[model samples]
Target: MKWKKGLTGMLLAAFLCGAPGVGIATPAHASAGEYKFDFGGGTVETGYTGVSASLSYDSARGYGFRTPENMRNVSASVRFLATGTKSENTFDVDLPPGLYEVSVTLGDTSRSSIAAEGVYQVINMTGNGAKDRFQIPVTDGQLNLLVTEGKEGAVFTLSALEIRQLSSNPVTNRTIYIGGDSTVCNYYPLDSSVQAGWGQLLPEFVNTNTFQIRNMASGGQIARGFHQDGQLEAIVQYIKPGDYFILQLGINDTNPKHNESEAEFKDWMRDMIRQVKAKGATVILSTPQGRATDFNANNVHNAENRWYRSAILALAQEEQTPLVDLNVLSSAYFTSIGKNATLALYMNGDTLHPNYGGARELARLVAQDLKRQGLSGF
Candidate 1:
């Protein structure tokens, strides 16, 4: 194993807790500034509009809101010097599900302030009002920031505020590292709309708060191909000890025109497994889902090319890695659904890759095996 280092080197945390919907209350305040809140239930950057605070930074200012053309200033970097003493002050921030470094700097350079995210679910910021920073995990993306105003309605001078994704693992929550090919890539989706990769659907079955499903898989990538594309390196960079790494790549490798002999394929998998294991992460290897098979034996992916899947299974045993036999389970599933139904689950009968339904089935099989093995984060 070359033990690909520096693979990790990107931002990496937290939970999803709250009612079915976040209750955003922008109560009446006597402040002269403006504010924008985004409760991210969907793509739109909109939320409740309460009494305005007019302190929005002017774009002409160099270090202010990097608001995209017509979008709201969700990425604003302004100082709120007057968020009054309302008994309860709460607002939801629309942040993407990922690890972030959140900070709140008070006005005075030598004073104390208690700034927090996740409604006291996370840690508190304590320091000289310069810049108090902390790592925060955002599971559902609609992050809640709670502030309890003083009895006299004092001025809470927020000299600075920062929220950005981390470039390293804070090790806040469990992570499922998905490593695979097109069948598992988080693609943009096709015309009919349901045909997406299985990895994209995996999140639905698992709990986002408990586990972060990091899809590092891509299209046209085998074990060797993934490494060549910097994916393997990226995986190594963030996969901490106790995290789970799912390896599912074989369909692309099985192509006759593709590079690598059977032994080379096996060796590549072995090395990847070894490397992942060294990082203190548990590994799960999955065989690719079976392509569309005609009962009359006329499919291009005939019996001869089936070795790629078996190689994955055999290597799993060789590496003592858990196996999610999608080939067997997916084949049985599509068969139960029948040829027409199976074709419907693909992109207009593109047997090679699965459509949305097919991807869901593949995800179900993996989820079953993962939960079966008692994986921690599912």
Candidate 2:
């Protein structure tokens, strides 16, 4: 919640629209260059500019719906900005180039996927009083937000919005790019999703003041496939010096359908490491965590993808890169907890993926390893 240097503290108010004595008329351009907007055609809250769904983007106004197709006010009393369009919609706000922390207050019954500057700030989040706050490096002098539906039949709604200028120079903030598989990717309808990746939950443990996470992991992605498909290049384009990249893959590679060899996995990972390191950024190699059922008959934890883990460990040693032995750490922990407790961590009875609780625990292990290694952004 901390901003750049020489900035005073500003306590953001929760969205309490239509509440008596809460709405105060304030000038459209507030002091300190901070902007607050109240959506949903409801009574404008104190110190916020009201924005209706119909308010199309105007250059003179500097903020409004740019692609507000079928977007309209659903409720006035509760303050809801609902969009009927099942497809993706956009909203724009003009601002000077810099790093900004956008805080959005979602409606009580809202489910949404919001991406600022193509970096997902909220993915499939839904529930009562859901709030999304994230920092984005804006180089285009404006913030283009993409909003889409989360769960089926659920609409996207925004109750309030607040933009705080974090730094005039976006480079002051470093990013931690994650390259992995579904076990480390983000999920939607996060409030109710039975499955979640460790990368999706890593932000909860990192120091946001120093680093932002961009999890580029996807389902069924192998080391070679991720690089050959140009996903690694996409991340390399944005990665800058002082940034960090974590590569955690291998589970999908073990599938016979992929037909990837252990040596090839190591080679592809090395190539990725070299490309990322060429940008003057640090590369940290992480072995995938163990599955819920990766245990021996003697109750000793064993990793199903131990071959990939061995390859990664060898590469880490050869490249002299920082390593997070998640397989070992997770396996040891699971063994200590016993079979039944470990099974409860996985989604349903599935052994491959971890549920939300499992994801959180995995992220904690990653963070702890980062700190143990004395890496930056712990």
Candidate 3:
């Protein structure tokens, strides 16, 4: 996905939060002019307005296809709108100037690249029961969305589109950006997935109205390699003043394959810290939690393979940044729960990663630490 600047300084992005579950339901506090479109000229899903491909843009309707002739309705049993040509996939909706949570349901079989307001909203999301919901700022009084093919031979398909205004706007809202490894990244099929990261569940514990949680952490990431691979660049583009950057890494840095020395790890972290700080964003350094299998025979959880913890602590003091000692917090929790029960927290008894329950508990600890440190978001 690419980022583009709107006249209102709104940042364009389609950060995936979760996949399709029970379909779109009406918000309890629905805003005026909220929209729900069930595309493809078939039986409209409950609570959704039916939209056919032949329906062109009409002033009375307030929303429609820009080029109706180029679109096709392939729905027979289930509603589906498909377009093989990129130029023909344009759709528009008239929305008041504000931030809106756009929920789009894509077809299960084919992949698609969705862009709104000249910025990619959903990028290359394809799978069974695929869906994406993200907040986007609308400044031009209209939400212009384009759905194009994701890859070769993949026609763009749309099942539904729902738009609801949000109280949070891009200009005023502060975001909590998280950067780290698999232990802090989001996993797919959130409802069913056993694996999860603390970053993924952090949103549940924080105030979303004040801060948006953008978890950029991914699996198999290290201190130096994460920046080298251009992951930080994505965060750097959107991070601005009043935003908080929470960094928790070092788990993968110890791997011999990464070859990241202690000094090099600190150097890379310092680089990331300075970069975000330069953007007027506050940096919060955190020690990655200890592994589930890091306990000794005496039933005590030891901070093994966490050599970078000391460096992180030192840098937190040296840089005068807030620190969340997840290593200490998580270790104490595991020890309190006993060895057998602690092992149950991890998926398949894996030491390095945590299951959903474990991730939620870890996230709770992180949230508590943030509150203890008096961080603004908490």
RMSD of each: 16.3, 6.4, 8.6
lDDT of 1 by residue, 53-103 (tens): 231223232112122121121212112332322212333345556666554
Arrange candidates by TM-score, descending: 2, 3, 1
Per-residue CA lDDT of model 2 for 1-378, tens digit only, reads: 111111125534433222323233223444444777666655665546666777677777777777555566655312223432222355678888887877766664546655665445555555544555666777887787655555556766666667878778865368888988879877654444678899889988899888888777776789987797545865676688989999998888988789998888889999999999899899999988877888899998978456488889889999989999999889988999999999988988588799988998899999999999998778
Q: Which ten residues in a row have the lowest lDDT in candidate 2?
A: 1-10
The numbered model that scores best in TM-score is 2
Q: Where does candidate 3 stray beyond 4 Å?
A: 1-31, 39-94, 109-127, 130-132, 140-158, 167-172, 188-192, 224-234, 258-264
Error of 3 at 171 (Å): 2.6
Per-candidate TM-scores read: 0.56, 0.72, 0.70
Q: Ten-residue segment with the worst summed lDDT in candidate 3?
A: 1-10
Candidate-wise lDDT, in order: 0.54, 0.72, 0.70
| Predicted structure 1: clash tally | 20
Better of 2 and 3 by TM-score: 2
Instruction: Extract clashing residue pairs from model 3.
Output: none
Candidate 1: 10-residue stretch with minimal lDDT: 1-10
